[model samples]
Target: MKKENSMKRALVSVSDKTNLVPFVKGLEEHGYEIVSTGGTKKALDEAGIKTISIEDVTHFPEILDGRVKTLNPYVHGGLLARRDLPEHMKTLEDLSITPIDLVCVNLYPFKETILKSGVELADAIENIDIGGPSMVRSAAKNYQSVTIVTDINDYDQVLTEIEENGDTTAETKAKLGAKAFRTTAAYDALISQYLTAQVGLEDPEKLTLTYDLKETMRYGENSHQRAWLYEDALPKSFSILEAEQLHGKKLSYNNIKDADEALRCVREFDEPTVVAMKHMNPCGIGRGDSLEVAWDRAYEADSVSIFGGVIALNRKVDLATAEKMRKIFLEIIVAPGFDDDAFAVLAKKKNIRLLQVDFDQKDEPTKDEVVSVMGGLLMQDQDTLKEDCHDWEVVTDVKPTEDQLKAMMFAWKAVKHAKSNAIVVANNERTLGVGEGQPNRIDSLKIAVKHAGDLVEGSVLASDAFFPFDDCVKYAGEHGVKAIVQPGGSVRDQDSIDMANKLGIAMVTTGVRHFRH
Candidate 1:
């Protein structure tokens, strides 16, 4: 009489059995029948909980090496039937199928299987769940009549509701359905991406990316904006989004963006290099025999602006380098590593963020960069192509000296990270001045010259793009800049070249233009 009048049925099948015994026990206390298959049923029985086998529910034995158990209509018919519809009940009555009110299912471990060392293709393929996704979708589609649970984290809430109210509220059911759909979608996307790559396609025909929430930030770019950080389900090795934070408070949204920008720029060099950044532009960059010297050069490049900037180093931060760093008020400092003595010294500044990057692990940088607009996204290649002065042509009669050539290359690297209409002045290995985000090329050049002043002498100037007029070259010569490097593609390029020749300044054309907006 209790089974006929008050009992409810729950279908539970899961690969991850975390908290299964207690959750099932909670359901049983409220007169709910649990029907399970395979290892889940065995675990439930071992925990001294009652469970009806899939064979009893389907009236058929599991066949095809345990693959065909839940694929039967008996399971789906009960899970999907509309309780309010007479026709559905009539069909179920004719088939003697019990309608399922609650469904608990989680997908197979395809992602973990593929990540294991030496995992065979057959093993990965076998782990793909055909029945689990189908059951999840059916339960989600019937959320008006059924409750779905995909995550073990939701078990406590679900159990509490069923214990107190005897059923989940409509709002809870909708939310669970939404999560269930996302779970299956992510599972399918991983399988699709993995198989496409294994079949020799460099990229899949349809790119599918899935991410799990890592944290909810206080806010986005502004306090009014909402934001959350999500890491890839299968992360790449070199992504800063997945980097471990070694010290200091939790990273804010702005800190993550600026730190990532700083690190990416520093990776453009192989020598001992330091990059100081503000508002996503490189305020200073230095290369030296030691990181300590590099930090000083970079800081001296813009002592005032580097006060609250982020710093990135390509080599280890030693105690000497940390000494130079401890003087400045930096938002973040990241390096491949820090000497224990250096970390000990810097750790005293409790507020400054410190991060140790892993350079030994490797992954390809993203092929595409995406920008968000009002209604859509703008996407482009990540501009990862490297340029070399060795590939450049000497456009002026006066050849650049060996030292000047080296300085030009260094300035060229810095110019690429500056905003459009950019100009960077550098000596042999460190930046002297940077003029960025100007409306006109001449204005940017003037700003750099003013910043450099006497330092402009003997320093090479690097432009992000070709000069539309000869005035930039004239201005450079007046400031005592001895060499110039720019992409030579403008219609009046020869005019600039003529001015360089006339001013007795050496110039080289890199042929490649780097435009950062």
Candidate 2:
């Protein structure tokens, strides 16, 4: 049986009313009646676009500050009624309820509320919409008989389709329904994460995460594997996933991952710092009074690894810095900001990925951190970057010199990029050597010393984790390591301390641990 195609009804409710007036008016022009609740209805009425109040449709007043407005069976039945089902039509007729043809809804600003300072639990709970999710889910589940619109961006398209064809296409309805479900899922995941964070259950087993795919990449690590970028919530900071490509090919999966890591590492410093990442691991890192010097020093740190790597800087990219960066072939170059001349210079490299990230918006929690085990999924908190170093305790015989102290702090920041069982040696704001992803602590120390070579003399070493034995300290001394920083929590802590005193190397315990694995 063919259903009647007379004036379709759309229920509109949105926290962000951007472009709502034109959209609602367009719907009205197409012989679609708008049913809206609370602020949305008020706004439409103020604009002289008549709307049926939700209370009129549901035959119930909005009590409890509008919380109980759309939760009734009338609302769900209108959205869920099967157009072709005889039983569904009979039920709707018996209740004297009109079937809802379309639902336009967006949840309250839970993500925004959590980001604001001093947001109380009551405030956060109040923002969680009960009726909104139910309506969205009902519309989505009955996509065959209903159309759902959750994003304002879809308003124009939906209006055009209805105007041209007298109804939305099945394909369009299916797509919108998919988007509606995704919206509700992401919203619920955010609420779950907030409650979990408040309770301090950060363990991987206890963590639950949900993210929507932002984009599918051209390829993964290689062209053979598939990859896509996802975001938990839209991050305000300079994020590769959020960046707009002015020109050049779409970023590969590896390019985005490496670019993100490099940007995060570089953004840690207020001063001009440059970080080059390859395959999601930092290959070169340096800081200087000027960005040009920093870029040059970082390139020199590991010129071989910097080839086709992602480079990130804390400060704005100037012409000189851009010129230096152009000398090498790179996959991407990201900075907090960029000057006109600098962007022009980089724009010439047609293939290089250029991104200007908002350093101010960079530190939100990632959507998910995944690790594949033997036929299982292992998830946990993202290896978030640390900003506090004041808690470090000096735990050595000789104290570090003022200059060495500054260099140690720099090395400590760099070491966070190294893989687990990592060792990093640096001096004068430059990474002298880095040993990462080794099986044992001593092997990582050996690699660091080997890479530093003669430069290891008078340099500071930073370990991502505590030393299990005194041999690591003795090895550092043999290579002329004069200062060390590690999270001192080994069973043989005294042995390592004694070894440091014998070698005359200043060591400090960071009380806090940074085990990447």
Candidate 3:
């Protein structure tokens, strides 16, 4: 590398000109020459900033509808040449090309184009830029002599450091270069995933993932460990992982985990529902005619556990609900939206995080889910919502009433939130008890009955998996469970149905099992 730092020359081409004017001005103020292409050049010129066209630098004109502009040898040679290598210098001299010290290039908005409903294939294909990734990779490969900037948010910081130090340090260049490669890699991964899905491909070997780090948490599960949050390709999906914090301290690892579980539980209900979660377990859950009533019922479900728990609501939070929530020491609260009055009421508790996520509209099932282990990953299909209730089979002499069937469905939804070997008992629209992560079905039923206490009378039960024996059904009858819903596939299904009939309890099979394990 050159021992002495020199005046920087930047190649700036971007489809998103969010901070282009100020960025180019900063480069000009720092004595850096700007070389841009096509619309980017026009944008800078219109913004009253001096710029050199890429055609002028390469001594060739842009052709093929702007696709052939920055792929020239001059551009790549300038970005890739090593200052310390004599052959590299000789090659550059032979080509009469000057080294590009910095590259601030972002690709065309392919993801944005694809996100638009009814977007044609031609439109999406045309948005994919060829030159942007090439220039980024070249600059990143030669990080010792080049600084690459792919994100507009980094523009001002990079400009400030260069202005103060004359040139970017090796550390800054290396960091920026790493980010640049990751940016292009993620972009390619997204394209591959989209195209593969578009063609109706079922090959699991073709699946790909692209994620970007949103923020680093204080710790993993505890304060002594480190953690970070990342999002997959889609940014429009308003997940707890994708939420932007409008106020309060950064989210801790436990806070995010609890908030995610709370969000998932609340999203399961179509009607207005409120769920309170602690340590990835639902402490309380309720649905009401109105959100305020639901919030109150959820709070009353288990008052002690609701303390410092994460609360999530399915509807827009009103002032009454916010006021009631403010009374407790909550870690976080999330809803689809908040009205002005509700926002004002909740804002008083500044320490709590309030997030708005449109769960009803954006609950698309993810294609792949990966869980990490000590040395590898376990991949599986995402747990998707089953919409067909009519397909469920009534397997008992005593069929459930319409109201009881609704409660059974609700209990089934609640069971999905519980851990494996889960059992949930509910009456009306409120969760009476949840038994989670038990070793067996009968044990789970016993736990649910024990937790439910007096509320188990006339309540409906939901099991995550099939009842292997009639012991669970007999146990439910003793707990006053009037109805039961489970996936029926075990060989002793007839015995279980016979037990339900003898006990005068209604039983149904969903055909589909929800095994969390």
The prediction achieving the highest lDDT against the true structure is 1
Query: Candidate 3, which segments miss by more than 4 Å at Cα?
Result: 1-9, 25-33, 46-51, 160-165, 204-207, 242-249, 319-323, 338-347, 359-368
Top candidate by TM-score: 1
lDDT of 1 at 313: 92
lDDT of 2: 0.84
Per-residue lDDT of 421-458 in model 2, one digit per residue for the tens?
Answer: 88889986789888888899899888888888888889
Q: Could you tell me how far off, in angstroms, the CA of residue 207 lies in candidate 1 after the best superposition?
A: 5.4
Candidate 2 clash pair list: 78-100, 237-361, 237-362
Q: What shift in Å separates residue 484 of candidate 2 from its native position after superposition?
A: 3.5
Q: What is the lDDT, from 0 to 100, of the residue 292 in candidate 1? A: 86
Q: lDDT per residue, candidate 1, 1-517, as tens digits?
A: 1122268999999999999899999899887999998999999999999999999998899999988888878989998899889999999999999989899998889999998878999999999999889999999999988999999999999888887678888899999999999999999999988888788775455767778998999999899999999877887656567666777888889998898889778877878999999988999999999898998899889888998899999898999999889987898998888899999988898989988887655335563566779997676777767776777999999999888888999998889899999999899878988999999989988888887878898889999999999999999998899999998999999999999999999999988999999
Which residues of candidate 1, in runs, are more than 4 Å off? Answer: 1-5, 61-67, 114-124, 192-207
